[model samples]
Target: MSNVELTNMCMIYDRTNNRVLVQERVKSWKGIAFPGGHVEDGESIVESTIREIKEETGLTISELEPCGIIYRFNDQTGDKYFVFNYRTETFSGELLEETDEGRVFWINREELLELKLSDGFKERLPMFFDRKFSEGFGTWNEHNISELKFR
Candidate 1:
């Protein structure tokens, strides 16, 4: 059986403000990015997503609309990584100013591209905003070079 790791990320959009919640991570993968985390064993994907968002942003979210997925494969180890992407305009609770992950806050949707984004996050944005494509596939070699495609 092939080794596969599952994770999730979500775009929490505040339609009223034309902004989205983003985390300025201070952890392994640093920079501005959406809030999410690994799927716990025995937890459903959606359940895990909801839990992660609440933990990371202190906001209880619902009515998630599946956006797309970002998939990566390590050629050297034959391991696969998948990030299930989602976006929602439904959420509640006061947003946390900071967490162990990073500082969480809102940014204007139009200005998203202007900020420094986490690695590979720039390419993944289309998946969150565009409805036509549902996948961002990438293959990484031993050298860490990758070729990505959207479909």
Candidate 2:
């Protein structure tokens, strides 16, 4: 059956020291992905990103700039998924002691790329690093990013 299986968002927070917020998801999928989660009912995309960051990292986002959107299509069933990508450098709050999702903390931008990351996130991390904003569509399996269409 056709359905929007999920709505999620990823955030890239530059702490001004070349560090960013990251989490290694343990409960669900395995890998280091940016701090984010599924969007709840009626919450706007931006709102969901903010809420997810706060819940998962104990950080209150003060500024969020939409960078792009990623649309994932299931290679097997043709189902679709959407993930909003955002970048921010302003926030307030102490880091959470721990999260059920995984360990949340700051890591150097260059060093973070060396860690094991989720497939989709691994492929999209460059976009965030380069600070390029665009819309993208790709297969969900490997996240073969076809091309980034800048808006």
**lDDT, model 2, position 133:** 46
lDDT for residue 138 in candidate 2, whole number 0-100: 67
Please, what are the lDDT tens digits per residue for candidate 2 over residues 1-151? 8567545555656666878888888987688888888888888888888889899989898578877777867776767878788888888888895788899878888798799887657667756777654767766455443443344
The lDDT values for all models are: 0.90, 0.75
Clashes of each: 0, 0
Tens-digit lDDT track for model 1 on 1-151?
5688899999999989999999998985799999999999999889999999999999999999999888899888888998899999999998999999999989999999998899878888888877767988888876885857989
In order of appearance, the predictions have TM-scores of 0.95, 0.83
Misplaced by over 4 Å in model 2 are: 75-78, 140-151
lDDT of 2 at 146: 47
Worst 10 residues of 2 by lDDT: 142-151
Write down the worst ten-residue block by lDDT for model 1: 139-148
Candidate 1 — what's its lDDT? 0.90
